[model samples]
Target: MHIENADLNLLKALDVLLEERHVSRAAARFHLSQSAMSRTLTRLRETFGDELLVRTTRGYELTPRARAIRQELEFILPRLRAMVRGGDFDPATSTDAIRVNCTDYAISILGPGLLPHVFERAPNLSLTIEPLSPRTYDEIEHGRVDLALSPVQPPAGLRWQPLFEEDYVGVVAADHPLTADRLTLDEIREFPRVSVVVLPQEQMVIDRRLAELGVAQRSGLRVPYFEAAFTALPGTRLIALVPRRLVEARRADHSVRLVEAPTELAAPFPYGMVWHPRLNSDPAHVWVRSKVGEVAAGLRPGTP
Candidate 1:
């Protein structure tokens, strides 16, 4: 390889070839005829001085050298693609709409600050807030959604930027007796509870912690939003384990008092934003992510 003689376009073809490991399938992926893809594969073999794909008992398999190239390509291709497509984005003049998928909990804490901050800087950009649903992962992977916020770790193949850590606090009616002192895990377990199950296994962290101590959230009310848990707490003995920030924000609005959760149960968990790697170096996306990071930084995770 000399740069001047090499056809840079074949890099993408080679990537698809190594990934698909079958000439016809790789050709289909690149929208080229089978014969054309075969020629491209020949060129790749000649350029690299190796048989990139070898016939196996089952089907085509990547040669060791091809495997090494595939590994490097995965890291290189996305950046190259982003660089080619990320042409001189100006946030103030750009009309890009960024869709964020998150729970109402995220909206309650992050929306108030994030919304205005983004608008102030990127005046022409549109921000769309959508609720996190079962289809969220698929939406983000396919670029239907630009960003997602969650405390749970993102599945592999996505990028995570930790925003803040959230600790759980027990909330009850202002006059509830549990507020008088630090409640034990057993005491907390004895009371009826309002559980926020925003997504499947959203409670796993708290649940796992409690389970280690031989306790569980007492069965009472189950709601889909964190706000619902707050509203459900007043005028009742329902003890809810909610984010400390939620209590700080709405305690005045509701007749609720925050009580110290057991030291063992008050472990703080990380909350953050996740996005696809294709947008890693995209200018407009980078601007939007930076603003989100700024807003998250200002939150300054605090103790109850």
Candidate 2:
């Protein structure tokens, strides 16, 4: 049987390639081989009469035409998905994998409570938590990540839902000599510090807070995850200002202690969930996002 426009699938491939900007990674999204993806890109260029993607010294970039079409594709694709699915999600039966983009810190704070809530309703569904990366925004825009949680707001054309606010406190080794419920600027500056960087362009919010207080952070150690910062304090004078909740969660295992930082330091930064406009109305996406919001609400201070 001859299928009319079997090539329609190539349009889907084109959307992925345009967002990914890398043929290899785009291929991985569709589980296609590199050579096949390259051929697909060649076909897309032929169909659109544009280069579509061009290699640069740094990496591949979409051509102007490709970029222009993406804005329209983002609008059409989700509608097309909803049309095809044609029904509300049944969590008990659906086994779809929900890809979540977040830091380990969020998993530490929300996962313990969130998982039970999600599994109770959707035992067959699975959640895959991915670490934050520079490409997280792109991943969401392109449909790779179903949801994202971060302190930084994403670009426009995405939904941002404020989940909870967080504040920072200084953490030190449980056996450290300085025995204060709170530390002054002079005391904090006494030791070399460690910092957490989520991605290349992203620095932790506390970095700005520290600079505001004129506290010189001797960043002898820099790590990617929040928990790594505590490892510096075991037998050393090193201390860091991490989320108060994070410190409380890990204190028992790491033998770390949390104390109030200088009075100049403010309360917690606002962290939130973000998603692409394309996924905003998808039933399954909405259901999972609702569950996440519920979990975040219960985890806030003074909630029973």
Candidate 3:
């Protein structure tokens, strides 16, 4: 098991390769030439005595050995980094780009409120906010996502803090007949629906609820964010069920009005921040996370 001139970069390379599961992508991450990366992969295989990434018809798949390696790395590396780097975090001087994986709904809720702080404190700070896609837990543990704001509950092994409970409401044109009063489930079911397309984690719950209610979004305007739903609802027969927070966020848009969904049809879920335990002691993460909690707490849940 002894090798000459063992370089730490090899382990780093293996880690990235297992994560990306694509040679070119991993090579780009390490800024290595394609042929150089291939040589590094060869060395990794020789050292580990396992084909860490085996190519499949669609793409590369990790062996169980690779998964074990990843788990080990996930346990050790970030905590080591945190120990070395942890300190008082001055948002004013922080230029590190904080990547938050979330839906547009989260962006609407967090970005504006956080930006003033981001600007006033960390003027050079850049925020990259994007949709929550598949393998969210893996992404968070691997440092691919610095934070997540999701309505969908976190999977086991991920740590989460519930920010607030949110209630769903029906929104339509200001003059839409459905706004005459709180909507009955029958009225909601009969309306042409504009569904909110969400991440994979949230998709199942949504689909299950819709199936149980026997309702379909017939308006044919399916969108990933509630903002799009707001845009679609005005001056049309389309009805959208979205978080009351969304209406509060975009109330100035003045394109739609919100009414309560029938009590039987609406369900409440907590939207919160989730992160990996590896980041537990990261000072910068702790500070911003607290700010997020403060914002979420102030946003008491109810009709906008």
Candidate 4:
């Protein structure tokens, strides 16, 4: 029979059928009905021009041709599988680079910890983080970017894995006059604000929620990064709502303190890794994403 016209799936069925020496047992292995497996066995006999399985007084037995084919498949199948499936991945010696797109605030929170964690395991692999933009998902789809950190829900045909939920906390200078354990919405509006606007009309969820409650802050300054928002708050009554993890991670760099956010504004938002489904099973991708999961888990205890 011509190889091009043959159904290669029968080869696998032949292998199992030869080993089992019973049609029903072989059918069970593949979860196929006995009638369906019998049809497959008939097709196999026609393809090879041999009765691959013959009935004896006691049970079924393999003919000479079937035994010879079985021996050949034992040698060929493993190599064929190896050729189809590539070699295993080893991160310690890998030089592959993974590109990630994320906001500066996300970098401020995850970068310091993620870098060290990745380096400790991979050492040779490189990580490139580009600023998140409207084209971020397009870049990922086209194979330019490997992952993205986002709170925005992804569109269809993409995959997301939640890393952690981050709370919004009020940040002010350590010596600001509005020194209260928790400030009311009216009190927060009284102070000038340092707003972080990474994209056009990109308001944080906290701000949107506040506006829904008829509260708005007076912006004394607008910056592009979360770190800048903290830096602009010192020696002034300017206040900002930023991620609590970001404030705690970079607190030593600036003289800023965290104030408890009001219950209305305390709703936490999820930050997750978004990636194209194409790389969902790639070994190297799977390994690095696990490392990322480890780093994110360390940020907040008991994260799954």
Best by lDDT: 1
Instruction: Please give each candidate's TM-score.
Output: 0.69, 0.72, 0.69, 0.67
lDDT of 1: 0.81
- Stretches > 4 Å off in candidate 4: 1-87, 251-254, 301-304
Best by TM-score: 2
Q: Which stretches of candidate 2 lie over 4 Å from their true place?
A: 1-3, 7-82, 300-304
Per-residue lDDT of model 3, residues 1-304, tens digit only: 7546566657778878888999999999989998999999899888888999999998999999999988676445544544656676677766455668888877777767776765786687656777788777678877767788887777888899998888777788987876465887677667788877675334645455766787654545777777777878778878777878877766676768878777765777778899988667777678778888877777645753
Count: clashes, candidate 2: 2
Worst 10 residues of 2 by lDDT: 1-10
Better of 3 and 4 by lDDT: 4
Compose the digit string of candidate 4's lDDT tens values, residues 1-304: 7998788878889998999999999999978999999999999999999999999997999999999898677545533543465667777876555778888877777778878867877898767888877788887776678889888767888999999988778888888888787767887778887777765566667777888888866767888777788778889888888888776776475577788888878678888999999778776678878877887887863111
Which residue runs of candidate 1 sit more than 4 Å off their true CA positions?
1-85, 201-204
Candidate 3 Cα deviation (angstroms), residue 302: 2.7
Cα lDDT tens digits for candidate 1, 1-304: 7878888888989988998989999999899999999999999999988999999999999998999888667546545654665678766676565778898888888879977777777788767788887678777887678889988677899999999898888888887867465777777778988878776755545666787798866779988888888888878889888888887877567488888788888678999999999788778788888877888789856665
Clashes of each: 0, 2, 1, 0
Pairs in steric clash, model 4: none
Cα lDDT listed for each candidate: 0.81, 0.80, 0.75, 0.80
lDDT of residue 193 for candidate 4 = 79
What would the C-alpha RMSD of candidate 4 be, to one decimal place?
18.4
